[model samples]
Target: MAALILILLLALILGGAGFAVHILWWIAVIVAVLWLLGFVFRSAGTGGTRGRWYRW
Candidate 1:
């Protein structure tokens, strides 16, 4: 998702879509940054956060 957004951003900037780029640039940047933050802070998915829920 984030990679696709980045590609689209690059394309918009390089393709001379000035108005489109100006409007959507913040959205693309926000999505990409949020994705990065989620990747960095995500749990290990080992059921540690679930505690006894998995055992039940």
Candidate 2:
């Protein structure tokens, strides 16, 4: 009975950690995508600065 309780506690802890990792992975992906998009726009804007004010 004590062994079963210990197993259940370990499983619960692992499950919670897995869920936390999943949430962090999604957040990392979103941040990476936003950073990539910002980098692309920065490169494009600097390539040609003339008459680009109205483009925005």
Candidate 3:
């Protein structure tokens, strides 16, 4: 009985995941495309402060 319940629970979770996979894949693709575009169009302003000590 316990094993049967566990199997049913696992099946439900897996079925839910499978049902949303189509939408999830599209969301992932859109995010990846946006990230690539941002990298391509990023600016190069403001140089980072290097490790330097100035004595007053």
Candidate 4:
């Protein structure tokens, strides 16, 4: 009985980790797209000079 419970717990933990990783992948893709858009649409800075959208 204890072994069965342990197996179930392990399976549950692995499943949860998989779900979290999938969500993280989606978030990464979204951030990448936003970064690309920022690069494409960067604003002009002082004295008509083109500058980066991000400070860094």
Candidate 5:
């Protein structure tokens, strides 16, 4: 009986870990998309100036 309980507990722990990993994967994808969008907007908005607007 004790061994059965331990086995069940271990399975639950592993299942929870897998769920957490799935959530993290989605979060990472979202962050990557946002970063790409930011890069595009930043470069275009700068208009080739990059470092400064009109050099004072």
Candidate 6:
């Protein structure tokens, strides 16, 4: 009985980890798209040339 409970707990933990990883992947994709859009539509800065959207 204890072994069965341990197996179930392990499965639950692994399943939760998998779900979290999937969500992180989606977030990464969204951030990448936003970054690309920012690069494409960046505003002009000093010298009348395009400047980085991010300070870094």
Residue-wise C-alpha lDDT for candidate 1, range 1-56, written one tens digit per residue: 99999999998788777777877998899988987876666655565562222223
Instruction: Give the winner by lDDT: 2 or 6.
Output: 6
Which tens-of-lDDT digit does each residue in 1-56 have in candidate 5?
99999999999999999999999999999999987776566542355574422334
Each candidate structure's TM-score, on Cα atoms with residue i matched to residue i, is 0.44, 0.70, 0.49, 0.87, 0.75, 0.90
Query: What residue pairs clash in candidate 1, if any at all?
Result: none
Q: 1-56, model 6: which lDDT tens digit per residue?
A: 99999999999999999999999999999999998999899999999988889888
Model 1: what TM-score? 0.44
Cα displacement (angstroms), candidate 2, residue 48, comes to 6.7
**Evaluation by lDDT, superior candidate among 1 and 5:** 5
Clashing pairs in 2: none
Deviation in Å, model 4, residue 31 alpha carbon: 0.4
RMSD of every candidate to native, in Å, equals 13.8, 5.7, 9.1, 1.3, 5.6, 1.0
Name the candidate that leads on TM-score: 6
* Global lDDT of each candidate: 0.73, 0.78, 0.77, 0.97, 0.78, 0.96
Report how far off residue 39 is in candidate 5 (Å). Answer: 0.6
- Model 6 has a clash total of 0
The clash count for each model shown is 0, 0, 0, 0, 0, 0
Candidate 4 has what TM-score?
Answer: 0.87
- Least lDDT summed over 10 consecutive residues: which range in candidate 2? 47-56
The lDDT leader among the candidates is 4
lDDT of 6: 0.96
Reference-based TM-score, model 3: 0.49
